[model samples]
Target: MDANEDLSPRVMDANEDLSPRVGMEFDTLKDAWEFWLKFGRQMGFDARKHYINKNMNDEKITSKGFVCAKQGIRGPEKENMIRTRNQDDTRTNCPVKLYVSLVREIGKFKVIDFIEEHNHTLHLSETIYMMRSQRKISKVHARLIELASSSRIKPKATHKLMSREACGRTNLGFVELDQYNYLRTKQQKNLIYGQAICLLGYFQEQLTTNPSFQYAVQLDNVK
Candidate 1:
């Protein structure tokens, strides 16, 4: 026999029927199959086919229309929670809902934009300082000197170091100039739109992404 035939397949622990390490966890046999369905997506296996094949091999389980579906109802009590919020409430409809939901998301974008703009400005200033120290002033020198006094940027430098920190020292460099201008313009527009949307109140979930059962908070609190 070939040496390859002697090698054993990786045997999972016999006592541990569900492989938690492989993202399969089960509180019971039914839960194990359910978990297997979800896990199949991650593992590149079709869980539905696996379940079907298993059912085919089992006489009792296959005798039912579908093992789990045959025995279980959708459960009446839980149905109301998943139902769409009433459309009659125009105050809580589509775009308004999206708008409300986006406030936090847009706010995050704003904070990030500020940091990026500030960093770019600081870098420009530093570059100007380095150029002046080296005394390699060129076209960029004229632009930086111009920017130092103008609202085209902001906070003009009275001295060399201040200019570096303020205008970010790209005398006439289009890349630096374009970025500063673009971000200032773009961010304003985005903020205005986001603010308007906020007034409408979209995406406001009564409950956060966390499981309802995980927290002690009441349903009204979630709302």
Candidate 2:
């Protein structure tokens, strides 16, 4: 699939009601993000940080904001790549947003602006748990998944155990595919520079022994 494909079928727009009052203060970025997450759960939408600005002198935060996860249209840069996952064009240029900035004197972040209107349909309660921003594999669960794999337990069994502990599958707050995605990301990080250098060295040895041996590295358009 290309970036134009949307995994979720569109429904009617959500009744917008929950909103953050302008001038609300937060002690840290984490606090602000958690507040937004709570709002999303109640309002049937998701939020994501799209940009951040920092103070040059102290490297302190100056400004940042979260927008509807489906805030903007996909850019052309991703059009050439294989859409293995998460390339859905669900974004409708929704203007819903929450902007905040630092109050240097008091050293707290204050909400500067907000737009609660969303251009696209809000997620229904049943499916909201599946949204990227709402669901995540926490560190403790990730460790359990790793241990379960080591013990050769069937993945389905592990998932079932977790679901039962959480009271049911839906209450588990994540699915098997979500755990797989998290593991895939963790594996990528573990294979970073160390593996890259080893592979390049192997290729170089091949080139030295065989004159015609050749290799090339590929990167996406953005790189």
Candidate 3:
């Protein structure tokens, strides 16, 4: 398949109705963020961090919260125009939030609470793909890709391996074959550049030691 081709959406099975649950634990803050991002996409909404609580002494994050972008306001200008005749002016006020916090005992972050509600329409699957977070690869996924690339595995195979590994958990939705291909191509370019540098150094050494050395350059004229 072409790396850019839109693959089929991995929908949940009809029999499986696993909803986002409170107290879901993750190994690290990054893992927590990745899970919630996927959860938001699966639920047809966008996720963003509202705030992060930190420890004063160590300056480490102790808790983090996320909120839907659509939860904030629904076109205040439109609302103001509609209420022009009335004396009172009111705007959209949505209340939806999810909080996750670190548990010192377990050494993992857990969802403390989740307010599952939305005032706006859910985003389409195609539109969700355009979301920045959905398209960006997470740190864990990047590491996996690097490992796979070092083993000389193809991009498609690497993606398949990642998908298989993500089974029964929040899917690694951000890691796409196109990304893997791009990374591989970048690595190839770096290797070529390094080889060229070595060759240049060798030529420079020969030119300095040898008195009788000639180098020729050619260029094509184009209008």
Q: What TM-score, over all chains together, does every model reach?
A: 0.16, 0.69, 0.46
Q: Write the per-residue lDDT of candidate 1 for residues 76-142, one digit (tens) a residue.
A: 4434543554322111111100000012222211101100001111113224223211122234444
Which pairs clash in model 2?
none
Candidate 2 lDDT tens digits, 170-208: 566678888777767777877896798899999999999
TM-score between model 1 and native: 0.16
TM-score, ranked from best to worst: 2, 3, 1
Which stretches of candidate 3 lie above 4 Å from their native place?
1-18, 73-93, 137-223
The Cα error of candidate 2 at residue 157, in Å, is 3.2
Q: Tell me the whole-model lDDT of each prediction, alpha carbons only.
A: 0.30, 0.77, 0.68
lDDT of 3: 0.68
2 or 3, greater by TM-score: 2
Task: For residues 97-158, write the lDDT of model 3, one tens digit per residue.
Answer: 77889898888888899888776677686567655456656556666677877898987788
Give the residue spans of candidate 2 off by over 4 A. 1-18, 76-88, 185-223
Q: Please state the error at residue 41 of candidate 2 in Å.
A: 1.3
For model 1, the stretches where C-alpha displacement exceeds 4 angstroms are 1-180, 199-223
TM-score of 2: 0.69
* Count of steric clashes across candidates, in order: 13, 0, 0
